[model samples]
Target: MLDTDAWWRDAVIYQVYPRSFADSDGDGMGDLPGITGRLQHLQELGIDAVWLSPFYPSPQHDAGYDVADYRGVDPRFGELGDADKLIAEAHGRGIKVIVDLVPNHTSSEHAWFQAALAAGPGSPERERYIFRSSGEEPPNSWKSVFGGSAWERLPDGDWYLHLFDVSQPDLNWDNPEVRAEFLDVLRFWLDRGVDGFRVDVAHGLVKEANLTDWTTTSTILGGLDPAGPPPPMWDQEGVHEIYRSWRRVLDEYPGGRILVAEAWVAPASRLARYVRPDEMHQAFNFPYLDAPWRPAELRAVIDETLEANDAVGATTTWVLSNHDVVRHASRLGFPVGTPRMPGIGAEDPQPDAALGLRRARAATLLMLGLPGSAYLYQGEELGLPEHTTMPDEFREDPAWERSGHAERGRDGCRVPLPWEADAPSYGFGPTDASWLPQPATWAEYALDRQQGVPGSTWELYRTALSLRREHGLGHGSVVWQEDAFAFRNGDVLVLTNFGSEAVKLPPGARLLVSSEPLDGDGRVPTDVTVWATL
Candidate 1:
């Protein structure tokens, strides 16, 4: 068993989108019992912790993010007792549980929001959430993440702020009552034996007090042909105050709980602030994930993130894919030159299949060898490729409607896990039909298929995680290489050949793990390689 004290610092956290992970009942949805049943599979993959997305009681408008209650488990996922069993079972297997904390907003149907609406401006509950007068417009013209005005008109003709879906109303972090309520929520889970949290939309806790329109003329979301004014409240400076308070609350726990922030922004320096000791344990560094599949670009992002964040004395975290994004294989030139596979296209063809596996293993090594914690989306360890053809009718993500179908949406990556290759429903459910169809080609990529294969991506993940546990790879300070993509500390050098062709390692460097096989002395004569330790 890995040590629980610093488990998260170097840990490989497997993200389980609870609704899609596994379903015990024939409900065509995943639940706690299903996850509890699958604990041994997670143990086999060597993941130190499991980061379950929000399973709190919600109306299901924003999938569990629109939390109606913070302390209770969603009946759809399971009862409160089921959650306790899952926690205990996970801990029994030496796996820590870090649940997603959506403290930034709550469902519109939540009792707090309902009370605020009923009481209007005069009630003390009015301070629990952001509510503006009918005469006053939203503080600014900030756009909601789901594509409409960030402010919603209430029944009383006033406006309430919602940064994402209209169903998700933003809480008033500046209000002491709001902060105390969330602290109580934190203690609720901590008392239940949850190990830590991956704070959702962490930077949105506080907005600009001036309520001024955005003025920064930068274009990072899309093109900047005629750069538009920046949204007034994307990354306001005041959010840190609340974060420091939350950090203190976490410290009050016995185990010194972990806190990871979902801070997605350009310019690594700006993202680094969230990771300072007083704020968060680490913030997601998405620059590398957003970069093109080019050696120089990847190298530059790695160097800049490490260097800039080093100033703040906090580690960086990396993720390639999650529920919100497309799968990595398709994103990074896999099955090159093909428009995404049709929903009914042939399964990863033979030779191409092996190539895809190799590339995934290489990328996994890159993430693991990086400076901080690494996040693995649910099926990534099995090298699961994206489901290219999610029909419109079956699409559950709000991104589909919000993006006007311009983007394919995140349903591809959020497909249910393929637990049993020959099972009627690929083991996602007892019935053959699931909420989302299991990819027809999942047989070859199922966990059952790859578990014991010596060079499978599954084995590679096991090896990488084991190396991290045995060596202090995630704990050490990173020393960047001048020209290449390498980080070293003392005698240990972790190098990656992001190129397609082979590259020679610095003299005396030994290959600990390589995308391809190495010679007897542990060297990769050709490209797309990584070397660790000595």
Candidate 2:
């Protein structure tokens, strides 16, 4: 059930990538009607809310991130009326809805962008975006997150900055027009009864003055640098003032509306600023997600996470996997220190599936037992792994092309979900075709096949979520145990065995649930996590 008072503080939100979630029209793609029909499945899964990825009208250059309209839904997904119905239906079921807001950039096809291009260099239309005069060499040394130079030169010899794909033009947040437009956009969705927004590129809305050159030779992933003076393009102090204004707008509405930042900032303290009392409500705990699967490393990240959030009077948010990264079910199987890749292809080294699933289950229990909110990618509960062998011909991710085919990109994790064991398209839609082809082995992981099966990942999640709410685990404070790998939250103790040997539990402890069954010796085995009362 949704908590009426500050529900987002400890809510478990499920992210739905609209195109691959479920297709109701048999058009080979998922849509609003399709998602409306599948609400029952999420309700059964026990999630407090759903965070739908962008469905705004666009050319699909970046899979709907390049929004052309802030107030209307894409015709392919559904009309504005359909979105209204969805919000009402979801609210009736005691579930909140959060929609993605892409404020950093807009599609080149957006009316504002087209006018900017037609208005030439110095017009008011062009001021809404970053446009500068340049020679043949281009204006700056900034690199695109997708690939190539960050600047795109037009026929008029002027260039516009696009930190991502060329079809997505970065808005000049320095301009009053751009800032005021987004404020209106925020109120537009909140008026439609959305619970909140997942702000895309939340750390990138503001850039340093003068647009200086960045010459660091560091390898960056998802706009994150390990350690150094960060690039001027991200996490600027001006971004905070923007969010503070946004906070005021959110406070105007009742029912505790929230704003979640998808910021990838560094040093736990820097991330905490995004969640300050007057800023955002929550920022994703990426350090926890990026930490290697080891006891020492995991413990350190947890401590850091808790301390950082506590200082700012904000609840911490935990996430294992999302649309832009490899699913944890496959990622945890790789050796520690392996650089996280966008996606794996058939030629890539395959992960140990059995080992990955075991660790993933254990990780979920540990994360759910923590004192804060958590997010689950759509199919992670089903133990879904990446479609590691997708052919290059079927790739749709812009990164694949932008990187000149060196990276396989994230299409593998965005494949449609399997709902039935024997149904066409695994019951993802009425038609046999899915946006991206599904793996032939997907049937075994179908929801119908794992429904009531003991030891199945689906059943494990159902049981864990039920217990989480029942025991107030999300609201509990952690007390570290004698073993660094174990912690007690209220009356429940959660321990994870990261070593190769089995660990014996203390005497008189009553086991409540475990990721895997105990060994014959009644000890916790390697890569296993258990919750018990002592």
TM-score of each model, in listed order: 0.88, 0.98
lDDT of 2 at 168: 96
Query: What is the TM-score (0 to 1) of candidate 1?
Result: 0.88
In candidate 1 the C-alpha lDDT for residue 437 amounts to 72
Cα shift from native, residue 445, model 1 (Å): 0.6
Error of 1 at 65 (Å): 0.8
- What C-alpha lDDT do the candidate models reach, one value each? 0.74, 0.89
Residue 465 error, candidate 1, Å: 1.3
lDDT of each residue in 1-534, candidate 2, tens digit only: 233247888899999999999999888899999999999988888999999999999999999999998889999899999999999999999899999999999999999999998999789999999999978987779988888888999998889999989999999999999989999999999999999999999999998888889855222245466477778889999999999999999999998888999988888888999988888888989888888898888888899889988887788899999999889989988886676877899999998888888999999989988989999999998999989999999999888998898889889999999999899999999989799999998999999999889989998898888888888887888899995489999889999998889999888889988999999989999999999989
Report clashes for each candidate as comma-separated counts: 4, 0
The TM-score measured for candidate 2 stands at 0.98
